[model samples]
Target: MTLQTSLDDDAAWQAVLARDRHFDGRFVTGVLSTGIYCRPSCPARHPARANVRFFVDGAAARAAGLRACRRCLPDDVARDERAVLDAIAAIRGSDEPLALAALATQSGYSPAHFQRLFTRNTGLSPAAYARALRSERAHTALSAADRVTDAVYDAGYSGPSRFYAAMKGRTGMEPSVWRRGGEGMTIHWAVMPCSLGDLLVAVTAKGVCRLSFNETAADLAKRFPNATLHAATAGTSDMFNRALAGVEAPATAAQVPIDVRGTAFQELVWKALSAIPPGETRSYAQIAASIGRPKAVRAVGSACGANQVAVLIPCHRAMRTDGTLGGYAYGLDIKSALLDKERKA
Candidate 1:
């Protein structure tokens, strides 16, 4: 089927003029005057509207005696795919971290330019991606290995100090604790009715580990399977009460300690979200920029969605770049109500 089967001719022409990547691959832009065709997102100067015709694919354009443009290489879908894959393979193969310049060089791209390209395509900078790969490897080793020290080194960490530094606040548990799937940890949990829904509050002795809406002990069991999940009697932990209060009136909620866990980048995102004033809001782009990763806006949104503790970190304060409520785990209605409550306060 042709693009005309789905996209109208005028819509396809508008896409060419806008250089929209969303339209690329659905059709080719054939210029009758120059006998050249390009992907919809091609950067070449726009041809006269009368000279342009849309084709279903490169083969269709070639059949009409049109050659593909050299710049965008409309026919070579695997060109950039191979580069991204090769860089990923290089990062995973080496025991040590690869430098940005080195990885960009291997891909025949300039360091600064490739940095943006890699981040845009992967939703992570090359360095962050490498850390994530190493961290995943470390998690696997730590979960099975008998000795923490041996597991750290086995995961390609330079030393225990670096491993601890890398994993600091990542799992919110000591290395030994993660090794046993929270074997030694005791999590006190309770489900309490709240303004929005039933709130699940689970805490370690150190701080509140989770605060979510409509979740239960069953959900808590999945996170800390081996750990003892004690059903706390009412008035058990003052911290849990404080957390419940926070869920109701976030502005006046006491500062309760948090024991949530996430990646290094995710931690940065959470920190930025927490810094947002209750009545105020920040765009996803602003949050990404606050953490010194301006191009990581999409990554910031993913981190927000991954957040387990609601209202405490205040992911609800995050908005779209266009000044709209993007989404919330609970619902847009809840997000709007929270913002309204904050604004009224």
Candidate 2:
């Protein structure tokens, strides 16, 4: 089927007229009458079909000199602002025992009120968001070859026990095991071109592990600086080929292997992302609260941003608190398309 076939052109145009957040970023509707293109979910009046054209991506619309719609601020939405600020705050205040009550107090709201408002605005509470931020920092540090203990302490985890517990809860494996980097285990991976650019699929002995895009082999190496990576052509490994095929289509009962290495919190966030069913979405704040940290809305946004794995981990399922489509490492266009596809499914 064609890309446009997937879009309910008439309904999409109506959604544009209504400025539906649900359709935001899904596709661009170009108005031949006004010489402008807009997100399908843009809130604008309907124009005649003769005056309407559609593009699969923003770049195509922009390349034609049709500006984005002003209503949805198609070009300006990003989830990173919250994530960045939260990360900075976590880094600066690592020595303190940051709590929900403390964050609520600082925000001038009671913990309950703060929780509601924060989740509404950023999709995560204060504490959970902060924990994710700390976890990300710890993961980056460890990925850079820092000792596990040193990275944990540096990330502000109070002690080894707490860090270990958090790690196991999130990753279903120990940090040491993750660091070993699929040593004796075999990982199956495939490279393919995709809508967003190039795609990379890596699976371990357990489940679908890593799906990344727009990165060269060199880039992948840098991302997993400490892990050993190998090139796998078709026919080299049945498991690897199976993983590639499975990711392209839905399947059941296949245990794909994963060689994931990250701080406890990031692993947790990623695991949560994976749990999101295809065709469903969760706000970033909801993800944070689900993990028992309700104060880390911003941090949850960061974890979503930091995610390296694509569809299989389902970072695309995350949305802004106001139901806005947010940033994706690949691009907002891809994020919108992925969500749209899932919604249709």
Candidate 3:
């Protein structure tokens, strides 16, 4: 059945009453009686179907002013262990520049065995996963105003020429041409101080784009060491004020402006990540398959690791096959908190 069918409202409500583990994070149930929303596996008393409302994400529910149930703590779950490890190993190894056969032999597994085990464990073969990771890192570096050569080298490529050629083959553009400033772009952002720590939102001209947490001027300096950041405090524009308000309350929606710069492959991966809804997840292999590169699982994981924007891009939603919480650029604790918050939301 299709994903939407799997989340049939009637069936999902029934699952909520039954506290089905499989339905965890699939959707949320808002109880009209208590004025709270909970996960399907919540231990709280089941509410009448007539009093329940379903939502795809906590932000939407919160936007409706419905408080999350304290008992279920739906928003506190993290990535499954299997998915985490698979994505992490894939990302870590992506920078290795070694041939797959030699790499497999060194790891004491046949290439075929390695491929199967990797896919089974992380949902993607090693090579594809590695490439995605490298591309993502390259993108993140480039977004911060780093030179193309610097981004390529930092992502473990030998040189800019090779990186440019590979990026062109994958995305049809030279990296330098993509780094235009936030010129005419308008981004929406939100800031929230929830269980996951402080949050920041940075939206693109098109939609919600960047989301970060517990960031300071120093942190921003570190992330974009070269860029100039402006603070908007006049409440003149809805976008700027929304972002500032999100920082104050931690869950409000805010729109701002963004200047994204990255290689074509990296851009593709980021776009795929942006499509993932909150509270749901996809494996690295699944992301690769979605992008029409079934063999690029490892690369997908790398791209996720390299993501600079946090929740807005939703890279944390990617996991390994065995249900493990994977490595996160911001740290495993933050990852765990973000996952838990969504699950419980």
lDDT of 1 by residue, 59-153 (tens): 88899899999999898533454566678679879999999999999988889977876664455688988887778778888877989998999
User: Candidate 1: where are CA atoms >4 Å away?
Assistant: 1-147, 154-172, 252-254
- The whole-model lDDT of each prediction reads 0.79, 0.61, 0.59
Candidate 2: lDDT of 112?
A: 82
Who wins the TM-score comparison?
1
Clashing pairs in 1: none
- Give candidate 3 regions above 4 Å deviation: 1-192, 200-210, 240-259
Instruction: Estimate the Cα RMSD of every predicted model relative to the unseen true structure.
Output: 9.4, 12.1, 15.6
Answer with 2 or 3, whichever has the higher lDDT: 2
Candidate 2: tens digits of C-alpha lDDT, residues 13-44: 65566654445444677786787777665656
lDDT for residue 113 in candidate 1, whole number 0-100: 74
Assess the local accuracy of residue 309 in candidate 1 as a C-alpha lDDT between 0 and 100: 84
